[model samples]
Target: MKITRKDFLRLSGLSFLAGGAMEAARAIAGRSSAATESQSTPVAQSVRWGMVVDLRRCQKEKGCTACTDACDAAHNVPRLADPQHQVNWIWTQPYETVFPFIQNGYAEQSDAGIPVPLLCNHCASPPCVHVCPTQATWKRADGIVMMDWHRCIGCRYCMAACPYGSRSFNWVDPRPAIAHINPDFPTRSKGVVEKCNFCEERLANGLKPSCVDACPQKALVFGNLADPNSEPRQLLRQRFAVQREPELGTGPSVYYLV
Candidate 1:
């Protein structure tokens, strides 16, 4: 009689069964328990991970793809020939395009036409997780928005819910497009959604995200936002920073220092 979050998810997923998506419904039901169980454990009460990107440092070298390349190599992201089908975990976009709503006169005057690197914001209140019927995506206690590629039913609810255009769906088998498969990371099959997880696995092993480590200019700063003394927090306090679409109230963990 008490319809919990898990119950709601299962029932919602079952509705898809009426449309002949049996496997998707099963995944939604079967994973709901595990998803509910994980909700509390992985969230660190005091550690909220976040990132700060120094736009000045990042733009020192024009057309740099080191960050993107490192992420792709570490995660085994495919480099498809067709731009439309490319699986992007982290990539660059025009400055104006990145922050269309913000009226930053300083950024417009100084940093115009710069290619800003974009990735998952890992919002504190993630819309993607809420819309997912299968519980394939959820937010960790540490404030990282995570994905369970195996549990994904290709419903693309998460994709639609994400305002940043971060999630990528595998339309074709991704393995062939990867130049060199990383033995450590798993390759995704066609039909699931994938995106940056802020290097969740690497963080567990006491390492920085690949993009942060690979930046020659030391542009990307990763640390705990909850810790006031952390690099990210320190930088945020000392510099002028902005997030993408803050008006939407997603509480994006990623910030850009201009």
Candidate 2:
């Protein structure tokens, strides 16, 4: 339950506006939680972290769980045999179900039943943030929608607000279900709604998100969208990419190159 120096520095800066965050961090640490280290300072407009999924490369081979397994193991996501209690940070789903709008005649013309990876989009203006009465789920300086677990009351409001159905709530003690215990990150208890945070702690630690690093196919691309020279931005300029549901105008950071 050792708190990283990065988290110490982050709490030090936040001491002014929110003394509660410090106390919460202490409580989380006591629970053997991985405290999310915040940005040293407010991120400027030039830093908008985003990701790209090259669907062309994401096709799963037999017995392959490279990206999903790595992400869950790193984050301590649990596996529940109960279908109703299943929790997924990042996982593959049928293409038609993922992109329901492209249905019937539209979907049949394309990939059809192919499985596609999905996760939280970490939108530019996340509806979850707007609906959170406790402000538990809030966007960080770098275009990331992060959750303050301590502040989360487990009300599931964020889950209701998210149009993408990206959020998952804990129905039981999620810790016991974790097969691989990577102490680098903390595990969640029952009742809190959780989802992909875009691995903000890894970003602060000068590392890529576990999922991105673990991908065998190099299908996930993460970078600052504001940087025109970045790989994600460069790809966006050259290749055609589409959001999950652009009509909602959530301004999702993640794009899929189908």
Candidate 3:
């Protein structure tokens, strides 16, 4: 006489089959109730997505390259024989050069001592979004800055607008140089600008970004900044971190641990 949760679900399924008219009426009532609840709940709008990069945990032993590899493979990023022709959608850049001002008198430091992973900062006030003449780049309601390749006129204004040097233009046909390709992520055509999308496709499906999932050391944390309960916001609240070019007032969502 005592039905467990699983047993109750099973019984409910059987009842749907047994009472056809009643089940249909219940379904309609359930839908109406759901609508009522939805209207009363006041749907949450406005999300500020952000990331936290823990430098203390990132000592290069983690082989953070896995994130780079996953992103490159997913996007079908091309490899160039010449460094000038090389294009990186998401890759590591020298920490010293990235923070040259921070270097001060340490210009000759070895690579072993300094390493930084660079990607689209996904600024709250993204300059790329502002400079795009065709409105090719935009920030989504969920706080993701995305690109519309079809609308891009290839003027490279976004590239100039970006202070982080995150945007890359396809000077040549990238498809020919792609060693491997992932069908899930679309590749950009030549004469178009592309950069990190924060794995928007994955985020849309209630999944974490590929880079966050791929990081072995768990250094990168991504979540909604608006929700204080989100992992990223909680991490930021608990940890002392720094944002790249904070004075620029771009309001970068990405944060770094020093």
Which candidate leads the pack in lDDT? Answer: 1
The deviation in Å at residue 131 for candidate 2 is 0.4
Residue 244, model 3: Cα distance from true site in angstroms: 1.3
Give the best candidate by TM-score: 1
Query: Each model's TM-score, in the order given?
Result: 0.83, 0.80, 0.77
Identify the runs in model 2 with alpha carbons over 4 angstroms from their true place: 1-44, 60-63, 103-110
Q: Please provide, for model 3 over 190-254, each residue's C-alpha lDDT reduced to its tens digit, 9 standing for 90 to 100.
A: 99999988888887899988888888888888888889899988888888877778788887888
Clashing pairs in 2: 34-186
Candidates 2 and 3 compared by lDDT, better number: 2
The lDDT-based order of candidates, best leading, equals 1, 2, 3
Candidate 2 per-residue lDDT, tens place, 1-258, comes to: 898999998888788648787778887686433223342334557788999998888765534578888889888899998978988899878888777776767547568777787899999878998788876887887888899878899999889889888899999988888988888888888999999988888999999888999988888999998899999999899898989998998899999987
Query: Model 2 lDDT vs. the true structure?
Result: 0.84
CA error at residue 208 for candidate 2, angstroms? 0.9
Winner by TM-score between candidate 2 and candidate 1: 1
lDDT of each: 0.90, 0.84, 0.79
What's model 3's overall lDDT? 0.79
